[model samples]
Every structure is written in C-alpha cells, then in structure tokens.
Target chain A: MTTSKSNFSKPLILVTNDDGIDAKGINELIKMIDSLGEILVVAPDSPRSGQSSAISSGYPLRLIPVEKKEDFTSFKTNGTPVDCIKLALNFLCDRRPDLLVSGINHGSNAGVSVVYSGTMGAAIEGAIVGIPSAGFSLCSHNPDANFSACSDIVTFTCRKLLEQGLPQSVCLNINIPASDKINGVKVCRQAHGYWTEEYDRRTDPYGKDYFWLTGQFINLEPDNEETDEWALAHNYISVVPTTYDQSAIKYIDTTRNLFSE
Target chain B: MTTSKSNFSKPLILVTNDDGIDAKGINELIKMIDSLGEILVVAPDSPRSGQSSAISSGYPLRLIPVEKKEDFTSFKTNGTPVDCIKLALNFLCDRRPDLLVSGINHGSNAGVSVVYSGTMGAAIEGAIVGIPSAGFSLCSHNPDANFSACSDIVTFTCRKLLEQGLPQSVCLNINIPASDKINGVKVCRQAHGYWTEEYDRRTDPYGKDYFWLTGQFINLEPDNEETDEWALAHNYISVVPTTYDQSAIKYIDTTRNLFSE
Candidate 1:
C-alpha cells in the first residue's frame, strides 16, 4: 500500500452522493473528513439509486446551494451520479480532487449492486478524470443508519490513500456491514450475485395505472472467503479495488479462436 | 458457423430493450425479429440508459401492454434492464428462449459505455438466468437513424447463437458503426476509453441558476486494433463478449498480498 503524496498543499477532496443532502450517512462521512483537507460537495438533490452512471440527456441539471460550514461548502444537484461528478469538476470545483469520495451510501453496494450503484458511478467518474477516489456505503438501508462503526475505517482508509497514492485507473468500493463492531478491513473481490425481479401493478386515483418494481437478491458464490461478501458478512470493512474496464482478459485467447474464420 | 437447432420447438427468441415500447429503436428491433420466432418485448416505458444491471429495490413492477402488432406483442414495464429479464423469465415468458436479444440502441454503447448501458444489462441478466443473449447497438444518436444495414448480420448472428450456443456467463455486445459499407463483423475487446465530461451551465426562465452536463468521447487506445474502437473505425460490427462479474481476478494476488498482516 503506497501512501498518498503529502506536501504542504492541502489535498482537494470532492464529495458527492446518490442520497440527497439530508442523508445522515453523508453527514457522518463529512464529519470524518473534517480535518483532512478542503472539502466541496455537489450531491444529488434527491436519492437516485440504481441509476448507474446515467447522465440526464433530456432534462437539464439544476444545481442549488445547500448549507456550508468552514472549508465545507455544499450544493444539491438534480442529476445522476455521473452528472454530479461532471458538474463538480466542470462547474463547481476549480481543480480535480486528491480524492473524490461518494456515498457512505444508504445500503450495501456489494456484489452486482456495485455495477448499478450511483455512489460507485461517481467514484468511477473521478477515476476516469485521473483522480484517486472511493465510494463508501453502509449495509443498513435505514435513512438514519448508525454509521458509528464506519467512521474510523473511513478515516483510516482516506488517511492511507493520503499516505499511499492509489494505483492508476482504479477506484475503491468500501462497503461496511450493519453491525456494532468491525473486524477490520479486508481487500476483496466483488461477489457474484444478482436480483430476481417482480412487478406489482396498481391503479392511480384518476384511474390511470402505475407499477412498482421489486425483487430479492441471490448470491451464487456464497461460501467464497476471498470475496467482498465474506468480509461484509464477517463484520469487516470490505475494500474492493474496482476498475471501470470490464474486460474478460483470461478468456480472450479462447474467444478469439471461436470467432476465427 | 453451425446452423439453428434442427428439431425442437421453433427457436424461441426473447426480445427486450431499455427504451420503452414507443421508442423507435425497440420498434425497429422487434420488426427485425418479427419472423425469427415468438417475439415477446418487455421493455421500459421510457429511455433507461446507464441503468447497468441495477434492479428496482422498490415496490413490485407493473407490466403494462403497449401495442399488439400481428405476431408481435409489445409490453411496457416500470423496471430496470435486470427487471425486464427477471420478469420475462419468471413471470411473463412461458419458457426460456433459445436466444434473447436486446437493443438496436439509438446510440453507441461501445467502448466504456457498456458499463452504463441498460441494454447490455438486460443481456447480462439473460446470461445470469441461463439464457443465451446478445445486445446490439447502432453508432447513431439520431431519432430516425436508418437500421437497414442491420438485417443480414442480425439474422446471421441469431442463427449462429441458435446453432453454437454461447459460452456460459457470456453475452455479446455487438456495436455497429454508422456506415453503409461495413467491412463485415470483427470479434474484439472493449476499447479502453472514457468521456471527458464537460458541464454546460444554464439559467432557467425562473431567476434561478442551474448546470447542464455535456461531453466529448475520447478514446485512450486510439491505435489498438484489437479493441472495439478499431473495429468501429474500420466500419465493421464489433462483437465483444462483455462480462459483469467485474472481479479484478488478475489483481487479486497483489490486493490480497496488501491485506496480509
């Protein structure tokens, strides 16, 4: 683990989220980074989960000012995770951050959820911009999720990154379980899992129809100890060094031959 | 290539999309697959790009009928890409299809766009459900972009999948460049590239300020011919096997070593 460069220059930290400003999780996260460096937040005005890296192609984004404290100015934006990052860099922040941390998301972004996590989308956008970043999420979905256990780990991880510069083209996804105690941090791989979907139909007050989508999660590799799931389940903070490129390098050879003329 | 399955029930081809039923893309796609088999479309009522493999962790999904064309049934749903696949398999479709096809997406889902594409999400969901699937996209953003060139290859690809079943946990991401004279199909890897995001600031008619995000696509590996970008540049349909496991398997050794006490 290489440490982030530490000169006299204060590290510029860009903070954003999928959950809106009122989210207690982000509040707790903000407290942890108070003394680290300068902070600027431009998060979504409302929760935009399962939005992935979606950018508003039709509707324009609206950035509104939110409460700010010393060295911590915040704004709420009507956009997706990707939109928030774009706004932060191109409009809000003068320069890129030493780190861009998203979430402290309301729930787990482990396994397949990571692919669809707005929190992660922001982090990946930061990595795309050549900035070392991470997305942190608690396993609890409660709006007032007790983030007591995650604060120390979050601070430790950020401090570590501030010490050891992260590897290029990679962002970290740190998901902590909903527990009173954390075993420690474990660098692990994304667990293999997916959701089984179901649709419930209903009628509106005006006789118009509406639908709500819901589902249950299924993990294929439940017993894998080297996975993020194992770490999270065992009350440890799981740090998965995630990459944006989803290439199947190992099978490239076998696949190339399959398409050969 | 091998031929379609010789004697079982006519090859069942499941059709779905990220675009709603009214979307010209899905309509064009369904028309293309009209004669392929029993075509059942379970798509969103609106465009859902960048949805990835995210699911509706909310209320039950509502599957609504959109339009009924002769031998083609169209249904609208309030769900994500993964939702459409799960519902089509567990609730809607009578049985798993020999082939599941998603998109002739209105825009390019090439390069790094696959990570955020709801189109590919649907296809990946199909693979997870033990069904062979393929996602097709046209490198055009025009509302009425011509898909006349897509016929021969799509039919041939469908036949190929029906014959030589795709490898497990694999689905094809076929990105067709916007050109009439294509150099045939090229099997390639995803190009390492990203959008250099730029946000456009705007003020609404109301006295309030806001921001709109925009960007230009930049290819990092401009000279790499083994990538999807090169295939697109050469005016060929790039068929890259896109995966979602997103496990940094190669880096596991290094990362695990970092975690060692």
Candidate 2:
C-alpha cells in the first residue's frame, strides 16, 4: 500500500464521517487509507447523518482526544461533521493535511441526498479550506455494509486524487453500489431528484399528536447514464465532481427580472 | 399587506429560520409576512445559525404545536432548519405551501456563507420540493439589531418572488446591508470567498486541551462589484440566485482523466 509519498514523506490524511467514530464503515475506511499515509481520525462522537454542513456555533465546542496510535491519532467531538473538520484543522492537526477524506458513509449520499449529507459536508469543508478532499459512500443503509467490494475502488480514487490534484475548491462525492462485485468507475453528474414527504403520525403517552419524518427519494431522470444515481444503480462506482459554490449563473438573469424595480 | 390573497384565497406561506422561532429577526419576519398569507411558522426550538441544510434523522423528532392564530400557525421542532420544513410540509401544512421564506437572520449570509446557512437551508429545502423560496439576511448580528432598514426590502423581494416565480429548483439568498436607507435591490452572483481559521484554544479545569473555533470570512475577489459581497458592502440589497445542484460540470472531464484506468 506504500505509494510514492509513503516512502519519502508520509502524507497526512485527515479522515471523518457522519456515522460517529465507532461506526464500522469509517473503521474500514481508516484501515484502508492508513496504509497510504499517516492518518488522523477526527469524527463526531455520535451519529450525525443528514446533518449537512452544520456547525456548532452558538455554544462552545470541545474536541476530546480519544486515542493515539502509531499510524493514526484519533479524536471525537460532540459536534457535526463540519465541526469535526474545523476542530481538526484549527487545533488537532500539526499542519494542513495533504488530503482529507470523509466517509464510507453508511448510506448513499448521491442525487438530492447531497443537500443533507454530513459525510459530504466534511469533504466540502475540507475543500473550502483549500485541501484536496473526497467523500465516499456505499449504497447501503445497513450498519454492517459489505465494504470489501469498494475498498479497491476507494484506494484507487484516493490515490488518483493525490497523484493528480483536483480543481481548486472542488471535492469528489464517490458512491459505490452494495453489490459484492462492482463494475468500473464512471464520472457523472448529480441526478435531478426530490424526496416525497410521507409522515407517519403518532400519539404520545399524554395523547398529543406528533409526526415521524420519512420520505421516498425520487430521481427525476433515473434512466440517464450520465448521472450518479444511474451509475450507482447499475453497480458502477460513481464519481461526481462537486463544488461548494452554489450560484446558478445561468438563471441569474431570469432571477434578476423578478426583482427589477 | 393583504393585497389580494387575504380576501379570496389566502396563499399559504411556510416560514422557518436557523435562529430559533423566538429570535427577534424571525418575529420581525413573521409580523411582516403574516398579512400577505396564511403563515405557518415551523422553526427550531433553539438557534441553529450555521446548521446549513441539516436534518434530524437519527432520533425520533417531536413537532410541538405552540400557537394557532386565525391566519397563522406556529410549531417548534427539536430539529434543524431543514427539519422544520420537512415537518411543515409533511404534517403541519394541509398541502404544499405557495411560498417558503426563511430568515431576516440577525447576521449576513453573503459570499461563501450561503454554503453554511441554516436560513438558506430551509429555503433550499423548500426549493428542492418545488416551492418558490428565498432566504433573507441582515448585516447585523445583534439579537436586537434594527431590522427596520431591511424590512421593506424583505417584503418587496418575497412579494416579487410570489408574483413572478423563480426558476425551477432555484432559490434566492438575499443579503441586506445595514444602512439607515438602501440604494435598492440588485441581483448578483455569490462572491468567491473563504474563511481563514483563527482558533482560540483553552483548557478545562482538568487541564485537557480543547478549542473554540472562529474565523474571518475573506472575500477572494473583494473588488468585484458583480458579487453579492461587493453589492452588500455598497449598501445594495444583493440577491444571489442559489441552487442545490453542486455538480462542477466544467471539471467533469478533468476529473474523469484522473479516474481513467
């Protein structure tokens, strides 16, 4: 697993995820990426899935050092994924890491799911801070997902990213399918998608009505091979180049007309 | 304020924000928008300023209906701003809202701040579900900051969005400068920016090291008048058209080359 940098200067790799430090997915990711570089595992102390790019601003945050290993140093925070990244960059890391990787997320963070993804949130934060970053996810919600199938692809993608730098402030959202055997990787765009709301109403012990939030993710163009959703559906590892800039430049003019005085 | 909808059919407007329901900013917003339509306020129980587009998926969420007025309904959720919208759309509102408005936030969410804004998160969630949505912010961070300067602009923009409709899945991030009087509104692009981290480290009574994260928002292109940051600096109400589709379409080939076997 020793690559070019591993021999001369071990690249410092900062790893994080939404599924707390104890989750099996992140441990699997740590085991694989540790071989490539000196690792720093800074992640949330609790599950923060769907936490998006949230930061714990109102209250003072604390970063507790959990463990120190030969190849890796670990810390956990009572914060969101983005918070973990900020803490790692500011207080924990000795220097800016050579690479930042998030996840092996328990569930897929493709399509519209990116908007509420804490896994991609950390990666985006890494990109924001001028670090090369990537977020990996498998298309499985189960805690004990089969990660062996995607390990090679993950290693290859991370190695490729390290070898050939990504565009400035751009990060990668790589999603692998749940199958034991995988097709080759494909570079694709995010599929246009929405989640249909289906709330399950329930009553409390005191007889007050409440609701449980759950939905169905609907891909508008599911058949399009140019999208991440389609690629993942067909068992191909999908790599979508993502940027933090959310400006829809093409629609600025149309939007301007609405606000014209 | 009740121009046409209040008489025949009141348009339902879902109102939410990152700065809890009780924040002075949201109250000011609610007071203004209440006349235009039937308002449903579903905001977080506490402040969630930098919460981005986070959702509470790990635990069972509780949506407690607090107040019900003749033309307005209010609920507080133990969730993020995005959760407020999801709950509102699923259980609170009879149908999808005609318009979704977030904030009149106590501070500016301009430039790169849009990527980490809970106010914008609610708006983006609204847009994701195919609603006309916008997030408004004032340049002041004080809880009691005078929102008087930007109230009219907020009303005008929301009114304009309601009247003319935005592009599909595209929402607006409107940042109002803190000025006694404004120069008027200008639709602008998001300024390319980054936050330089300058963390404050501290130790607890037990003498363990921890840190409090803080940073300065630095505009990479400060001199560009075409950006939201520039527009706000010059006292213009800057409206930046925002979308959730994060795909860096231009860099797809560049990224693909890296993944080639």
Candidate 3:
C-alpha cells in the first residue's frame, strides 16, 4: 500500500464497469485513461452484464480493497455496477469526482442494448448525480476481446467530456467497432430496435424443463444512417448522448386525452 | 387445471410485476383488470425489486405452473421482471398479447425511481416489443399495503390503453397515492430528482464491514407542478408517458461538435 497527500489541482476520476473489476475490458479502460487524473476504481467482483441500473438491496454490500497507489486506488464490491457508483459517491471518494467513466465493455451497448447493459447503467447513475460521465463498449463479446482499437476513442471522448461538460442529466454511450482500423466517429441516436428472443428449452436429467435466453436484435429501421446500430454496422464509432430521463414528452397530451375520454 | 379454447374476440392481456407471484400488490392488480380481458401471468417466483431491465443469462431459467383457469393462467419463473416479459413474449404466450401491464408495485416508481424499478422494466420491455403497456404503483412500500384505492385508477387506465393504443415505443408509468380518496389524476413528466444515499455501515462478527442502502429522494424542482413528484404530493395519481429510448436528442448536435473538435 502506498499513501500520499491528495493533489488538489488534478481532477479526480471514478472508474467502474459492469464486467467486474478483474475483466480484461475494465483493466484495458484503466490503462487507457491512466493519465487523465487521480483514479478510483470501484467495480463489481463478478460479472454483472445485463444488469441495467439494478441496485442491490435487502442485504448488506461488502467492499474489498484490491490496490492502492499514490494517485490510483481500486476496490472490488459484491454489488452491481450501479451500486459501485453509489458507494463511490457516498462512501469512498473524499471529494466529488470530476468525471465518471464506465467500461470498455466486452460487448456493444448500442441501440436497445443500453436498457439491459450494466456498463451503461453505471454511466447513467453517474449522470443522474450530475457527474460528467461516459460508457465505452466494443462490438465484441469475447472475454479476451482486444480493446486496442477503442483506446483512442475512449480517451478522446473522456477528454471532451472533461473539457466541455454535458448538459444536465446527460451522459455519453460510446460504441466502437471491433476493428483495428476504425473508419471514423459518428454522433448518433439509439436505434429503435428490439430483440427477437429465442429460448433454448432443454430437459434436465431429472426430467425438469428449463430455458436459456438468446436473441437476435431486430432493428426497426436498419436503413436509418443516424442510429448507433447503423454507425456500428459501417465500422464507425457511435457516440450517443444518453439520458436517464425516460419521459416521452410528446405523448403526454395524447395520453391525457385518452384518460379524459 | 381448466383448459378452454381461446376466445379470439377478447383481448389477450399479459400481467407481471417486480414483486413475486404471491405478492398482494400483483394479485390486487390482477383482480382489478380481470374484466378487461383474458390474462396470462408470467412473473418471478421470488421478489426482484430494483432489477431494471435485467435479463438473466449464462444460466437456465425454470418455470413452474402455479394456477390455471378458463380465462386466467399463471406461471412463475426464476428470473427478473424483465425476464418474465421476455419469456412471456418468446415462450409462454401462445399468440401475441394485445396488452401488457406490470405492477401495482408495492412501492412507487415515480420521479427518478423508474430507472431502478423492475416493475417499469417489465412495462418498458413490453413496449419495446410493440405491445401497448403500462405499469402501476402505489406510493407505499408495505407488503400488505391496502390497494382498494388503486382499483378504479388501475381499471380506468387499463381500459383506456386497451381502447386507444399508445404511440410507438411508449408506455405508461402510473403511480397512485395510498389514500382512500384520491384527489384526481394528472398526466405529468418524470420529475428530475436524485436520491441522497445514506449507507448504514456495520461490522459483522467476522470483523468484516457491510453497508445497507438507504436514501432520501431530493426533488430538484419542488415547486414544479407539472412533474410526477408534485402530482403525487398533491394526492393525485401521476401518469407519465415513459419510453425506453434514452437518447438525449437535444444534445446530439452539441456532442457532435465536441467530438469534432
């Protein structure tokens, strides 16, 4: 363990991920952003993919320190990605974090996938707390997926976020193509899409039936070039400004009319 | 068990909740909307609060048949609320459901709580699949909370949804006050708010420390009467048209500029 006085001038950065602290993706993210500022890594001890904004409750959460250095310290928790952000904000960090970055996730969190992504969940949680935040993901699911192509984009996005803060209640969802030669970057919206789920039903040795979840994403508008899905398909990094506010303002009046009738 | 031929004339309704199969809130919700259509319930076997759009993967999910009747049938699964919706859409329901309703949750899913609510997760999942959907919640966390006051609102809202479908990719988040006489209903937006978390730290007998999550919600705009928090505080049932598309459209251009520079 190494201890030193806090540097007051440098920014404090809180880093977290849904793929757990030991995952290659998160480690890659830390290495990419090491020069950004003072870093605090509080992440889940186990993989928590598909855990979107899920907070652990009805039980106590535990945190174990993994590493400590002069400007970088790390801890692992038996909590979800959102819980890690909450714990860091409320208990761990001595001062408010200047920036919060989550993931160089092993899988893409684009389009409708953000709703089921623990990587985006951490970033959303950070934005909800008024922190400039961003989540980065590669369009690959392999545990040993190479994140080398994402380093430049991740660093660029974080630098921009830190330089020019996002609007209130907004965060960035950045998805990179799994290619060494990235085409370019495109600012896009979440593509309107849904998963066409296929459950693999199987009978156990004891004759009990069970099902495993697997799905193919159905892009409602595949031809729309302004969506994250389209960007990723074209080998471009997609950067979608995301928010936690789910209110559909356009339908408020129509919904009121329906109730009135 | 009772089996009858499907009635094509009557709408097929799918009901689910974050609270487990036996929860009073869900049962009350089922009873309230029974007259609207034939119902199929696919819900978690155990409570899955705070699971927002979380899909269970890398493991097999088991479903147990609980009850069966001519017009009503239910199966409980070892999955999250969102998983229940996916299972219902992909595996359980024989035909496409005309409507999907979740909750009458034991607690409120208003303000910023929707991001953490398994009830809303089910509803959002239903909407993503193009089903007309809604989630109901009472502002009470009591397991045995009285839901008699929520009956009329629940029935009225469901009937309206069945009569006039919502816009694409939209769903309703209807939160009711726990009172015998409700003032009225208000169609409102989600209030901008954040929870001020307070972790109750304790040391176990094994000399390890743990934290229990507890928090108070702080409304960012307390005087805004157009928000759900204000409507709920005024004893009115708050109806927010919610969507799963979290893209911040207003910031897309600004973000593009940031990346370009």
lDDT of 1 by residue, B114-147 (tens): 8778889888877766677889989997879998
- Give Cα distance to truth, residue B13, candidate 3, Å: 0.9
Reference-based TM-score of each model? 0.90, 0.94, 0.97
In model 1, which regions exceed 4 Å deviation? A1-8, A197-211, B1-8, B57-61, B257-261
Best by DockQ: 3
Residues forming the 10-long window of minimal summed lDDT in candidate 1 chain A: A1-10
lDDT of 2 by residue, A51-139 (tens): 89988777677777675454568888989999988877776676668899999898899999998999999999988878889999989
Q: What share of the true interface contacts does each candidate keep?
A: 0.56, 0.80, 0.88
lDDT by residue (tens digit), candidate 3, A104-135:
89999999999999999999999999999999
Model 1 lDDT tens row, A1-261: 011123337887878888877788788898999789877777888778877776676577777777556457787888887787777777666555778889899999988778778899888877776787889999988997789888877887777776665666678888998998778888889887766654455687877655566566687888898889888888888989888776666666655665663
On the 0 to 100 scale, the lDDT of residue A79 in model 1 is 80
Best of the two (1, 2) by TM-score = 2
Query: Over the stretch B182-237, how does candidate 2's per-residue lDDT look in tens digits?
Result: 88888889898888764667778988765666789999999998899999888899
Q: A-chain TM-score in candidate 3?
A: 0.96
iRMS value of model 1? Answer: 2.7
